[model samples]
Target: MGVVVSLEDSKNRQASVKPLVDLTKGDMERVNQLILSKAGSDVQMIPEVANHLISSGGKRLRPMLTLASAAMFGYAGDSHIKLATSVEFMHTATLLHDDVVDESDLRRGKSTARTIWGNQASVLVGDFLLGQAFRMMVDVGSLDALDVLSTAASVIAEGEVLQLSVAKNMETTEDDYLQVIRAKTAALFAAAAEVGPIIAGASRAERNALKSYGMNLGLAFQLVDDVLDYGGSAAELGKNVGDDFREGKITLPVILSYRRGTPDERQFWRTAIEGGENGDENLEKALALITRYNGLGDTIARAQHYGTIARDALAPMPASALKSALLEVIDFCIERLN
Candidate 1:
């Protein structure tokens, strides 16, 4: 496998989403309007909670992917707009539900909806958005799109359950963790990219290519998130650092550190992660150990592995502005470490 290119090796590697953003700007505006329209309701609190996350300055990358994938095929219709909006709603609902599950106090560097409106309100509003997303899918009149999205919803839930099962369990293996992230994170990305070509009536090979690209991109994205949780700041990650450790969630860093540490270091991790000794002091200790083991660096290397696959997934497609933008996005996902 090709290793991640160092920043020094990749000069002029503009690893930002600007090209894709610029290409999909007009469609994304419509998607945003639809998102606001669908998130509205007679119940005031529903919009309040929904809008909290919606307006929280997220990159809106998922919906943009839908738009880009469709436009790449020269799709000139309004259906992509609704589908893109539906994709955004699905993503927003997941965030609301995740905050409640993780008991997260913040999202996108702002207070989470659950913290302000309570977990019940957050979960209910998430459900409301999900219902609206399906309604939009139904409006599209494409059973294929519906099947892809609905199956993704089910798989995401299963991923969450699997993660919960492994929480605080030091025995979690690398393959086990990969399975959790694949379902929880990658499934939506795969669906979002696939449905675009599905609605555009693209060939099966074209659709499968985008799906594979999205799945590996999602894996790399989540692995970078794992690295950032320990090494990044609240502004960078949009959440408190060490939050995962406090929650006893066994991420890649913890798994690596635990597996490679001496017995005494392993015992310390057990005390910190399992025995609920995850205070600020322990968080400091955990950081030291993670650095000592180069866990953060190695996790980035793993993300690079998936990123390479994502790039290769695009190889069969003809080179174009859209293809170039999509390929650069893979670099952006991993090179965030730089």
Candidate 2:
């Protein structure tokens, strides 16, 4: 699906998430069960809407982070499972809400729940999932974990608002873009990773390290996602290739393309993104300008910068199967740009 051969980094032959998946398999099963159990409700429509998204194909990386983080510290209690389930619920809830806010028609190559159930039903179901998530968190009985996760919820909301403010605004800077992703995407990752050690009662330094790793990994992941919107296909991205452009979202590629173009090119961007001329012709033009300005390449470079930091974050930990798997996950995040 990556027709752009130039972007594919086949050199990272070792990049794979299989290790992490294998390492966390047993606990992940328990987490998945808990997720299904918690997502159910007496209200038939609740499960119907919740399962619509929950059953959709996804890597469930955030919940896996929770499991691996705790397991890394030798946490044996079942609380980690509940925490992982809670993390997944939080992530799913966010996706449901995001689809509504973005007015998206597709997710994971399927119609968004919002499209079928309607925005009001989708939103209410999202709130239900969030409520269930907090319920599971409370059951876990870790104040530190709760603190981290609750903070992340608020931060994610703030990020959404910040994104709304910047959408179609061509002046959005790289720093502004970073701030938005750190909140919306990376906050959950940071909290998910941090809670694992918190629940395990690990050293503060260890928790801090995992938190750092998760945040940087998320940043790299999102940067690559922004690149993929222009370079990837629906089969690969699990969504329409030009969804971001059609929505007038000012992602990293668009920001770079607009800021680094000729005056006429900049005007084209303003018309397409800000002035609501987001037709197929405009999307084609936007893609050309993005490729011409090396927007995808430079964004990937930025992703690599964060990937290095994420790798460094794990240096202090002793080598193990899990540690190696975690590193591979980092590589997978950046390599997805291909």
User: What residue pairs are clashing in model 2?
Assistant: none
TM-score of 2: 0.97
Strongest candidate by lDDT? 2
| Worst ten in a row by lDDT for model 1 | 1-10
Mind giving the per-residue lDDT tens digits that candidate 2 earns over 14-55?
Answer: 477888999999999998888889888899989999888888
Q: Name the regions of candidate 1 deviating beyond 4 angstroms.
A: 1-9
| Per-prediction TM-score to the true structure, in the order listed | 0.96, 0.97
Model 1, span 1-338: residue lDDT tens: 01122322355655888899999999898888888899899999998998889999988888888999998887888999988888888899899999999988978889999889899999999999999999999999999999999999999999999999998888898999999999999999999888989999999999999999999999999998998888876667788888999989999988998999999999999998889999998999998888889888888889889999989988998889999999988888776643
What clash pairs does model 1 have? none
Predictions: Cα RMSD each: 3.1, 1.4
Candidate 2 at 45: error in angstroms? 0.8
